[model samples]
Target: MIRLQSLTYAYRKGAPVIDGLTVDLPSDRRLAILGAQQSGKTTLVQLLAGLITPSSGSIERLARLSFPAGYQRGFRMASTLGQNITFAAKIYGADADEVIGFVADVTGLGAMVDRPLRDLSVQDRMNTSFALTYALPFDTYLFDNTFTVGEPDFRAKCLAMFEARSRTSGMIVATKFARTASQFCDCALVLIKGQATYYDNVAQGVAAYEQSLPVAQPKPAAEAPTGA
Candidate 1:
């Protein structure tokens, strides 16, 4: 379980991005964080992962969470994909061989695993990174709007991988779409403005989110030409 107390964050001389909020996140199931653009979803995820410090208040994390999966920022473009995996596994104390093997098999990197990251195409690199994300052990996995990346087949495979992980680990996925939330999550956390509401059922939360979205207004037809 994670406890968030009076959480607040703000940039310098700016309005609060996350205002006085408190919630308990129990790591027992999948949770979808639903939000519109700039709704603080990414900020909240980073705070929970201990990647960023909240400007005020506190967070108590009692479980280990993987960094945003397929996060390629930490990878060195000059090194081989396998080299990167070996280094990360050492950092997390996971078996390097197992992770490397998994990445090779899932991404079809095979011998390319021994090649430099600079040599792989962007698509291959992305696939490899995603495979490596699932190769580690964590109590819960974290994601930040990464569900639609790559080709359709790759996206489908990644979703399947997430489902497979769900059987043993927890996941917190942040997305802007209610459909995406309802598709993969049992519960939902909706972030509107700076406030949040946690719904036990995905349907309820999706309804709340849909209600918040602005309805598109049809354009008025051009006025008919006035008779001279």
Candidate 2:
């Protein structure tokens, strides 16, 4: 459980991305954050994961929440793949060997784990980033549109792993896609213009988000013969 009180964030004194948000994030089930672009979905997820400090207000986390899966901010480009995994495992209190084994197996890196992260191919980097996601365990896992990683086959593997883990771990997914939310989440949190509204029903939350979209202006009925 995470309690947020008057949470707010702004970019360089610009309008707040997240404004005065105060609510308890559910950890017993999956909660999908539904919002259009620039609606603070990612910002809220970051705050929950403690990746970024809020400009104002406070966040209190009661459960151990993992960083957003596929987040590469922790990667050390200069370090070897094995060394990076070892460092991350130590930081997250996971087993380095286990993490290393998982990544190497999935990426076919084997002994190549000794290679620097910068030397790895794009596919290798993608595989390792996701492989490391499940290498550690947390009370709650956070995701911000990180479902697909690496090649299609590797993505399938990641999905399989996530499905197994979902049975026990809490999940919070931030996405603008309705299909993603309906497929994986039970409840939804809708964000609009920096404000948040929680919905017990995912469909209802999606409806609210869609309703907030700017409606296209209908073409003025071809001004039929105005003042002749």
Candidate 3:
């Protein structure tokens, strides 16, 4: 379970990104966070994932949470895919051999796993990283709009992997696409003006989000150039 109490955050010299938000996130469920670009969806997820601390309030986390599984920033650019996986397993207290076997089978990288990260193609690198994430033990996973990233076959495998993980772990996925959110989430939270609107029905949440889009006001007529 994860609990937030009066969570608030703001950037320096900027309005609050998340304001006085409070919520309890229980385990073993998928939540979709909906927002347009720069709506603080990423910021909220980072707070939930323990990547960043809130400016005010506190978070009580009881689950072993995985970082954004779709992220590749943590990889060692100079090391082999296999070496990276081994290092991750060691850090997470997982068996290196088990992680290697899982990554090999899932990514089908074969001998390429032993090659340097710099040597692999983009697709191979992404697939390997995704596989490596599952090699550790985590009760919850964080994702930031990473549901799509590769070839059709690879994507199909990723869908299957997510489905399998859904059976046992919790997930918090942030996405701008309402349809995708409805497809994978049991509940949704729409972020607007640094506040969250909760909806049990994913479709309703999407609808609410659609309704909240800012209507562009017409620009005022350009002032005639004043004579100097």
Candidate 4:
């Protein structure tokens, strides 16, 4: 279980990104975080991942957590794919070869595993990142729009993997894709201007977002340009 009690944060004094936000994440539930740009979605994920400290309040975590940050793909270019994954495995004290094999099988990174990371395509790099994260045993997983970069089939596969993992561990996914979120998430958090409103269902979340938008008024046709 993950709990945040009166959490608050600010990059500049008196200008908070997350302000006294409190929530609990029941284990093994897939939660989708929806918010417009600058709504503090990424900031919330970072805090949960322990990448940043909260200015006030407390966060309680029950188990290990892993966050797939935007820069995780850079690890793919650090060395051979196998080498990078093995390094992570060593940090976690897992058998490197065994972990590599399992990741290769699960992520379908067969021959690509042996190749230098620079040679891999964007999809392959994403696969490597996911493989490394999934190989680790963590109780909570935080994904920040990583699936948006892959091809359709690969994206589908990634979604399946996330769903499978969610059956055993908690997952918090922050994305702009409503359709994808609706397909996998058990609950949705709709954030507007840094304030989060809970939505028990994805459809309700989407409807709320649509209702918040101001309808566009059509512009009158421009008069014919004066004779040049």
Q: Best by TM-score, which number?
A: 1
Q: 2 or 3: which has the higher lDDT? A: 2
Q: What is the lDDT of candidate 3?
A: 0.84
Compared with the true structure, all predictions reach lDDT values of 0.87, 0.86, 0.84, 0.75
TM-score winner between 2 and 3, please give it.
2
Which portions of model 3 show Cα errors greater than 4 Å?
A: 215-228
Q: Which should have the higher TM-score, number 1 or number 2?
A: 1
Winning model by lDDT: 1
Q: Which stretches of candidate 4 lie over 4 Å from their true place?
A: 69-79, 93-95, 106-123, 219-228
Q: TM-scores of the models, in the given order?
A: 0.93, 0.91, 0.87, 0.79
TM-score ranking from best to worst? Answer: 1, 2, 3, 4
Question: Per-residue lDDT of 103-159 in model 4, one digit per residue for the tens?
Answer: 788667878777888888776776667766767777878887654346676567666
A best-first ranking of the candidates according to their lDDT comes to 1, 2, 3, 4
Ranking 1 against 3 by TM-score, winner: 1
Tens-digit lDDT track of model 2 for 22-140: 98888867889998887888888898988889999999988889888888888989999999999999999988998899888877788778889999887788778877887788888
**Scored by Cα lDDT, where does model 4 land?**
0.75
Clashing pairs in 3: none
Give residue 121's lDDT in candidate 1 (0 to 100). 90
Lowest summed-lDDT stretch of 10 residues in model 1?
146-155
Per-residue CA lDDT of model 1 for 178-221, tens digit only, reads 88888889998899999999898989999999999999999999
